[model samples]
Target: MDIIEQAAKRLEELRRAGVEVAPEPQPSVGETARKVGAGSTAPADAQGVAQSRRVELDMNVLTAHGILTPDSVRSQLGDEMRVIKRPLLHNVSGKGAAPVKDANLIMVTSALPGEGKTFMAANLAISIAMELDHTVLLVDADVARPSLPEVFGFDEERGLLDVLTDPTLDLSQVLLRTNIEKLSVLPAGTPHPRATELLASEAMNHLLADMAQRYHDRIIIFDSPPLLVTTEARALAMHMGQVVLVVKAESTTHAEVRNAIAAIESCPVKMAVLNKTTGHVDGHGYGYGYGYGYGYAAKSSASAART
Candidate 1:
C-alpha cells in the first residue's frame, strides 16, 4: 500500500482503539485561510492551486537578531552555517558516506534549553534556502515553547499540530511563505495537551513522508525541543533522518550531552554543533565561533570534554 493508504489504515486502527482524533471541519478554503490569519491574496503555483499565505519577514529585525538573510552581506555566522550545511546537503543528495532514508527531514535540538538549537535551526534553514538548487521549509516543532513566530516576526497560526490533528487541514493551507522565495515557515499551531502523542502518531509519519517527497530539492528543518527536557523532542527525533544537537560551549555538562545523544540514538545521522565558542582568529581579538563535528566524531569529542 502507498504511504497515505498505510497511514489512513493505521489512523483508523488507532481511532478504533480509543485514540481521540480531531473532529473533521467542513470550512471552505477562504474560511480556513482567514481562521488561520493567512491573508486573502494567496498566490497560485504551477498547478493553479492557491499557494500558502505570503508573509513578509522584516529584514532589519532579522539582521538585528543575527539571522542569515538572502540579501545580507557575508559574515562569520554565514560562513559557519555554510560549513555546517555542507555534509547535510550531501546527505540529502544521497552523496554522503551512506544513504539515509529521509535525509531531507532534519531536526535541530539541544541537550538543554538556552543552548542555541533554535538559532542553529534558523540559520541552517536560511543557508539552505539560499542555495541555488534547494528550497527549505522551517517547522517550529517546539510546541511547548515555540520561538519561530517571534524570531521571524510572524503571527502564530495553525501549523504542524493542526495538520496532524485535523485531517481536513492540508499542509499547504497553513504554511507561511516568506519574502525569501526559497524559505517557508510552519508555525507550531495551537498548543495541544497531547502534543507528544500527536508528534509520535502515524499521522505525523505520513505528513513527514509527504513533506520529504513533495519536492526533490526541498529541505525541512524542525526546531525541536531540548531532548533532555521534554519527551516531545525524543518523539520527533525518532523519525528524523538527521539530528543536529547544539551544545553550548563551556555551559552544557558532559553527562547532559551524553544523555541527550542517547535519547536520539536511533537517528541515522547525528551531528553536533558547538555554539558560542570564544577564541582568537588570525591574531585578531577573541570572537565567538561555531565548531562542528559529525556523527561519532562529535559524540566521542563531547564524551571526552570536561564540563
Candidate 2:
C-alpha cells in the first residue's frame, strides 16, 4: 500500500479501536497574545518591521498528536528529532563546509504518496522550533493536497498561495504564529489549478528569497508534495537548500528513491530518511535511523536505513 492507503487503513483501525480524536482547540485571548509577541516581557531584537497579525496554537492539541512539547527533550520521538535536526541546524547557522544557497530552506518529500513525508515534515518543524536560537516557518507547499490544516487542527483558508497570487496580501496577514514561540505556519492557501506554474514563477522565487533572508534566525521548512506525483514538488525543490526524502521501510523500492532524488538533483544537500521501520531490539517500539549522505551511490541497503 502507498502512504495514503496505509494512512487510511490506520485511521480505520483507530475508528474500530474507539480512539477519540479531540475536538479543535480554542486558544484564549491571552494565549494568542503571548504567542504573537503580545503580553510578553521578553526583550526583542525582533523582525525590524512590525507584524500586525498572530495565530495562536494550542499546546494540548499538539501534545495529543504526539508532536514535540516545550520539554520535548525527554520523549523518544524528541530524542530522534533532536538527532535528526542537528545537521540541518548546523547548515542553518552557516556551519557547513559547502554552505548551500538558501540553506535555511528545507524541503520534506517522498518518492511516492503514502510514505511518511508529511509526518516527517511536521515532526521536523516541531523539533527545530524547540531550538532556543531558531524560529521555524513550516509552509504547506503541497498545494494539490495540503494536510497541515488537518495535521494541526487549524481551520483556515488564507495562507501562502493567497500572498503569492495577490501582491496586496501582507505576508504577516497570512502567516500563523503559534503559541510555540518558535514555530509558525504558512498554509498552502486556497488550492490553485496553476500550482506548479505558480511555484515556478519569479514571484514565488522572490517570496522564498524574502522568507529566507528576511529573518536571520528563521528556518523555512516546506512539506512538499510527493516527488513522482506532482510537478509542484520539483518546483519547490529547486528553491530549497536541503531536501529530506522520506523512504518507507520495506515499501519504497530502491529504484523509486533513486528517481525521486534525481528529480531534485539540483539541491546542494540531500538526505534520505527510512520511515516506518519495525526494527528495534528489547521490546522498544520503533528505532529511527539517521544518515548524512550525498549522490546516488550513497547506500541502497536496508540494514543501514534511517528515517
Report the C-alpha lDDT of model 2 over 199-300, residue by residue, as the tens digit: 666667767877877655689899998999888788778888898888877888989988998999988888887766666522545453332211111112
Candidate 1, 1-307: lDDT as tens digits: 6535654665674475356875554689988878668644666666444568889999876765567788877766776677789888889999998898889999999999887777788888999999999989999999888888777777888899887766545688888889987999999998888777777776777677778777546888999989987887887888888988988878899999899999999999999887765543225443433322111111111111111
Residue pairs that clash (backbone atoms under 3 angstroms), model 1: none
Q: Give per-model TM-scores.
A: 0.81, 0.74
Clashing pairs in 2: 3-114, 4-114, 274-306, 274-307, 289-306
Q: CA lDDT of each candidate? A: 0.77, 0.71
* Candidate maximizing lDDT: 1
What local lDDT does model 1 show for residue 58? 94
What is the lDDT, from 0 to 100, of the residue 280 in candidate 1? 38
- What is the overall TM-score of model 1 with all chains considered together? 0.81
lDDT of 2 at 106: 93
